[model samples]
Target: MRVRVDDASAGQRIDNFLVRVCKGVPKSHVYRILRSGEVRVNSRRVDQTYRLQLDDEVRIPPIRLAEKAAEPVVPFGKPFDIVFEDEALLVLDKPAGLAVHGGSGVSFGVIEQLRRQRPEAKFLELVHRLDRETSGLLIVAKKRSALTVLHDMMREGKVRKRYLTLVAGRWLNPMQHVKLALHKYLTEGGERRVSVNSEGKPAHSIVRLLKRWQSYSLVEVELKTGRTHQIRVHLSHLGFPLCGDDKYGDFSLNKQLEKQGFKRMFLHAAKLAFHHPLTDQLIELEAPLPPELERHVVQVEQTEEKEYG
Candidate 1:
């Protein structure tokens, strides 16, 4: 198979490009072909890290995806809660338990569902990722230019993203700054994990108390540097774990919460603000808390004395 790189695909790593072009194929198999010189760019063997330039022609060997048990092509996701939209962007209020894109154990995610739903869309891609357990504002780029600019804006701190989370205990400080260096590592079983380490990327989060109960506190966390599980790690390191955070929370508490019918993490991307990548107009969007999480807050309050709001 021959694929021509266009503006939408330009600047992408060859490995990633191949993954998209060869959907349903295993990533390991894709790398196997690349390393064995079965794939070439512009008639020359290129390493997996090679970034594709505009007009580059790629040659791919024929591939057959191993069949599995009969299942639906797309996981049948409802149209996401639309936050804002234009020719250049599609902002969505993503719900918990839905991954941003497909890979690793997930058959298909929001990106695949969006593509399936809008078959006429020529270009659509996720601009940023939210954890599968996280809910709320997620940005999707409708145009490559918008994706590039949004990424640049996020890296340069030109964009603002805030999250709401409920953590245990009375977080005394009204406002606190957490600057922790975080390192990503894979577990022995190869699952992804993050932790605070001296030799790691610096992460910053400004947390403000929003509401409090005797047993829990709701805080708004603003990240200065985006990192995998930054908010969860930071709060966890501070001795306040996000309620129902299975990865870094009090596991006993999580089990108890689950028994109480409040399952899933209590983290949300509640607010986002940024300048238009193309029009230069400021865009601000807010996603209301999911009803389950709201009810969890109410449950906590009912079980304890309200301290502040």
Candidate 2:
């Protein structure tokens, strides 16, 4: 991918800037390309630490991203619940059981299906990611220019996301905040686990109890840091794992949820706030709770109220 340095990216190191702009580029491969002269700034081969100047033209040879591959052709015509879209980006309500991009035994994903619809579109990129089992709003960039703009917004911490979830305990407080340090690693069994390690990265989640039931609570969450599974991991560590979270939750609760016709994780990305990639207008998108989650929670809450009263 060829890149031109602009005033916004001025005075940044060549390697650092490239890694930020090019998604999924490994550190080693980035340096390898720089050393091998595959990357040129101002038509000259520079070291990895080369400091970029304003308006410097860069020539970047096509480099493969080892972590991501060309999306396979698998049912690319599947319909999507589009929330908002323009020439620069697409906002869609990604349902549970839909994979954002192909991986982890999912042969075809939302991106693949989108590509099939617009064959002439190039650089269809995801601004943020959502786990396959989790449902909610997702943003996809229609052009590379818009991709960079949206990414910069996220990196600068300007983008905001809100989630709604039902956790395994009755919370009566108006607001509950979890400030915990998270250390993540692959367990001996090759599954990911998070613990409250003092040496871990600092993480914080502001949770507010919107309602309570006999054995569950509906909470709204805001993320201060975008760690992997930050909300789920932190909540689980706090001993209130999300309902139907099979990986880090109670097995019996999961079974009960399944019996209630809940087959996927009980989580949703309910809202998104960010600047329009092309128009620079402040944009906010919202998706109401899916019927399954709404009805399930309502029933649970009503039963709990009657029993407790």
List TM-score per model, in order: 0.82, 0.77
lDDT of 1: 0.91
Model 1 worst lDDT window (10 residues): 300-309
Candidate 1 per-residue C-alpha lDDT over 175-253 given as tens digits, one digit per residue, 9 for 90 to 100:
9999999999999999899999989999999999999777789999998899999999999998999998988999999
Please give the TM-score that candidate 2 achieves against the real structure: 0.77
What is the lDDT, from 0 to 100, of the residue 69 in candidate 1? 73
lDDT of candidate model 2 versus the reference: 0.82
After superposition, the stretches of candidate 1 with alpha carbons farther than 4 Å from their true spots are 1-72, 306-309
At residue 190, candidate 1 shows an lDDT of: 96
- The CA lDDT at 184 in model 2 is 88
Write model 2 residue lDDT over 1-309, tens digit each, in one string.
567776546666899888877768788888998999989988899997788876889888887755666755577565888999887788999888878888667787888778777778755778888877888999998766687878888877688888999999877779877888889899898877777788999887889888777778889998876777888888888788998887787789899879878777888999899888778799999999988888888878777879896
RMSD of model 1 against the true structure: 4.0
Displacement of the residue 161 alpha carbon in candidate 2, Å? 0.7
Clash list (residue pairs), candidate 1? none
